[model samples]
Target: MDDTFPKIEVLINNLYDLKQKRDGNFEASVKRVLNMLMVLEKGLWRTTRGNPSSFTDSQVEKCSLQLWNWAVAENTLSTISDIDNAKFRHVACKLLTLSDPSSINERRVRLQIEMCLNAAQAWIVCGRYEMTDDLFELARTCIEKLLDGLAGQHHSLSGSKRMMLDRDLFSIDGLQFQCVGSLGEHDKAVIAFNCVRDKLALHPKEAPFLAMVCYNLALKFHKEGKLEECTYWLRQSYDTGKAEEEYKVDSCQQAKTLRFLAHVCLQWEAPHCWINALNAIELAIKEQPNVPGFLLYMKILTLSEAPDTDLISAVQKILKHNLPSDLVFNAVRMVMQNGRESACKTCLPFVCESLSHTTCGLEVILLKMEVALHFGNEDEAKKEAEDLIAKHHSGKMLKEMQQEHMHLLLWGRASFHIEAKCYADALVWYELSASFYAPGKLDCNLAKLYRNLATCYLELHRLNKAKESLSKAHRIEPDNPTTIFLNLRVALFEGDEQNASHAMDCLVQLANQEKDSVGRLESLPAEDQETPC
Candidate 1:
């Protein structure tokens, strides 16, 4: 026997004696065993076996099983603190040795894995990511072993043990989904997502888990550019999760899915899809009414090709709810988009008041710039922009604060120049805008900037430079009709009949695809108005 075997036997006997005495020394005995377990856990990291008492692979397995048996007999284990209760410590020690396969047997491995699965769940409940990852690996190994055993025709496990194995398999599958999602392995992520869905199908009562799987599948589909499939799963997630108040599903999740759906719709130029996004926002509000949802909904409604009057009522409701400064700022954007300048003016004071009450000082300055520009008060806009620049340059803001504030300042200046038709000045401001972290990878905005630059060059009759800017815009967005039209004009003016003919053919094809009266009329030449393209 190993030297540590003698010490282990002594500790086991002492623990049994303490249990028998029942002298209110239970806590002390548990702590001692916990300390000993900690020592053995640390030993897994050591390269040298210090003495005969040091636990070998077989002895560790034997002790872990004996410890579980003792815990079953004592019924004393309550928490990880009750290590002397044996079961908890044995599982904990086995988890520590999972990377060292030599220290665990098949049966002990299965028990240890079950215990680690429980521990991992507990850690998840506590929001401990590091511990959750450790326990998750142990659980995964256990489930993989069980799968292998089943494949080899091991004796069929019964009842709770079989259920436990199934649950562990599901959890491991969920973990794999998270791992693949984090690594951006969207293909593998989708496969794992389907596996989870299949697992959940076997147990339909697990609504929360099913919702999570659906949510993940939606995200993976979105990444893969499968818009219809993405929408389907997103709706499934929202529908499944919305039924459970106990889960307290985050409204942000629903809101994000809605927002992404709206974005995909916009990309596809599908007006009906935007209505679906609006519906989703309403559903999200029904689940958990909040300012962010209102803000997102308002933005979507404002951008809809056919704005609904009900959206206006919704905005009024949002304002009545007293949304935060940022949300109110978005409300201002919606109003501006709807050409409700007076409504924007009315909301200005409330926006300023909310900003003053918050610690986000620079945001207030930025909002002032926005309101000024919206109201055609260029002087006020420039003043706010200069003030913000001075404040940031004087080290009066945090690094993050400065970075955020500078972008607003630059954008305000850019908008001012663009509206004033001072395209040279606009180019300078846009160059500055390029230096900031774009909030949404706004390639559309960049494309617009290039288009504007191209227009300015065209005005100056610099056809080469105009072509260069238009090429940049086209590279960013190949199918934008406006860019195509502009490029066609450039070709015509440059007398490149071949290029002009090609651009016209593309425009005619797009016009035919639209199947609208205006599109057909636009495609016809001035003298050929009676003829179709």
Candidate 2:
């Protein structure tokens, strides 16, 4: 005889009738039933001043089902509508009252919210950004209301509330962060991350969640150029998220964090930092050994003044592991760095064989060409360069091979021409060498190139060109006593006594600058002092 009881009973019976309908005709009947139930549910929700338990069990269940169904259908309709769907908004508002956490059927309510959350996500992925935002805001509002309703019923629903809160926190914050990150609003993305960290801090027992938030925060800090803070957060994330026997954390995630930490350490460039990176990478390899870690470790070792024997053994082990091409390229570089040309010889067969399997083979070939050049094996360098040029015609490797090999070939040929006293031919090759390696910029290589060019010009009796090239070489690497002395000799030969005296003054100043042995400067051969022209 209760006034609301009869209305609840009628709605429950109507839902049951809709549930029994054939699938072919169920959609239309279910829509009609949902509309009636939504009105009653909303009125009851507003009138009831306490927890959702103020409603009867049958009423709660019927309301939850309708909310779930309406959320699902509204999501579908939003997808098809070009404009914002006002119908979906009305249904979502009704859902807010039905999803009270204090209700005896809290599990059902939670499931309904979860369905709506998923539907919202689907809408977002399908490019309905506006609708997705609206749906998310509604869902958040509903969850907040549910949390408020459960505040007085903490004893009855504490565990359930905690679980729901954790789920909602991760989902909402993660989605917001992702959306902001995609839009390149890094500042907002960082704020969202800090909010997640704050929530996790309140729930200290959620170590895995805390760790994930910290990891993301560290990445954000890194992007923002907060290196010290990034390091701090990365360590916290790694320590908290480390898998215990009970947790069984994801190995790949752990490895990613470890690699990131290692890279940061490597960037610091302290010897101890490199050592720490090596240790961290070793641990990462234990969890999920991959080519990247191996290669990174190799680079660190090669750059460090570490023992060659151990580094070589480690590189050999990596090669034995059937690593990817990029990793194999690192291994070859390690071999070359250690001055282990014999070790390099041993690796070439495997490296060449692996090249076919990976796009990095060209890189390995170019590295081998550099190694060959370092060892003064022009034939080997030429062959490797030619092979690489034939296989990969356009890329960093091809360009490097063309540039480096041209210089090596022309320089070697020029050196021969100089030795054979074919001064004109040597001048041609030396000019070609300088062109191949132009325009001179650095101290060592540019000085050497200009010195060679000046020698060829002197031999060809082009005193003006010789003096010009020597002056250029001196300007680039001013500290070279040989270049200064050559300039003096050139000034004397050209009968420019004033410039010759200036060059003499420079030579004496250079001699005084040589701290260890002024005798060495004085011992310059007479032939070197005399300009050929």
Candidate 3:
């Protein structure tokens, strides 16, 4: 209803209904549904100034009421138990497929693999192992494709997607050190749990995930009232988390462990666990109370209904210190959480300076760009981008990284122009950005990007360019009415009666499809309440 993905939502609904029926080949329908979900996911997740409001499940949902009814029964979403007992799981397995890559986009391939992994995981959680092997195979294929993207001979290690694949150059005292970024971890774990029973002891390298797994197991035990086991595993998890810092290996996100520890202390009722969790986070205050990691912990504590006096003191301490940029940014997130966004905006300068220097740092700088766009600071954003490009073109980051980064930077700059209604400038930036996409790799933004280009060209009276861009968009997403309508505009602008007539005919056919879908929904029994317009 918020119109986050208005045009695609309609297509998604139609596909949702088709997939749920007792007729036709469900495999095709399921793939269609998954493909649409993947597209919608990417479209809605673009950068925003502050917190992204479009990220919530309800805001970017996959299932419609008329289809995937299993997902709608419970607030947490339908589980295995929610599946219709009447239907055979083999039948369900036939329908729940690993969708093929809709486009050659690296992100799209990643999403395809993720979709399979997610489906396999849900089935696993529901004790449905029948389909995991097939599902895992699908995930494995995508990962291979992902590696191919990373391994292209011409693609230097500097590219953003490939950057994570680079082995960081750090070592100490006869031991190699590195950051974590493995796509195979999920399928490997699933296979190990399913088939490999006599595996070796947990590897030292896997300690981070071990801690996470143990902590989650502890929560499960706690729910089952097995307090002793719960407490033991929680301690193990906490100890492992503590080791992460000393080890200097990037297993978990910064401040995640402390936040988790604090969450348990505040949310769990058990006094023993509470004390341990509280103590763990409180100890962090001694290390760097003015740092982002510590301030984040303090922010977590402040969320408590009955925050301790010391917790309140920690927050005050953060304010008194001339903190580092990252800490100030963390403070901004905290301040914003308390409904003080204006105060956070005032702290953006510090946030911009906090970006790490080791990597291409495009993502970090993009955050600043987004905030600038949000606050309507065009000059500041433009200046920031210019300085970044200066550093990039000067070989601060590799040319390959600069090349990949240029696309995202262009897209960000285009967004700024769009906001100001500078259509010509926006079109140029988008065209440049779209050119930088990896050859053969599908860009999720392809359709929308060209569609915008078409609009911009039209505004400038460049009818030929507008028609060409719209045609390209049509090739990417042929069925989308939004693209079709814009294509109609191009045709009309050129006074091409044939193309205009064709576009209008297509629109009518699409409208009829929707009308027919509605009629079917209306005919269903009133109790189903399954239709979603």
Q: Pick the candidate with the highest TM-score.
A: 2
Arranged by lDDT with the best first, the candidates are 2, 1, 3
Candidate 3 local Cα displacement, residue 173, angstroms: 44
**Tens digits of lDDT, candidate 2, 264-314:** 888887887888888878777776778877877777777675565666566
Better of 1 and 2 by TM-score: 2
Using lDDT as the measure, which candidate wins? 2
Clashing pairs in 3: 104-441, 104-442, 105-441, 105-442
For each candidate, the alpha-carbon lDDT, in order, equals: 0.61, 0.63, 0.50
Tens digit of lDDT per residue, candidate 1, span 433-514? 4434233444676676667666656655779988987888788889777677778778878999999999888878877777
| Cα misplacement distance, residue 505 of candidate 3 (Å) | 7.3
Q: lDDT tens digits, residues 330-408, model 3?
A: 5544554554335445544444453455352554565455455445566766666666555555656535544554456
| Backbone-clash count (model 3) | 4
After superposition, candidate 2 runs with Cα above 4 Å error: 1-68, 73-214, 236-247, 334-370, 377-533
Question: 292 in model 2: Cα distance from truth in Å?
Answer: 2.3
Which residue pairs in candidate 2 collide?
Answer: none
The TM-score, computed over Cα atoms with residue i paired to residue i, of candidate 3 is: 0.35
Rank by TM-score, highest first.
2, 1, 3
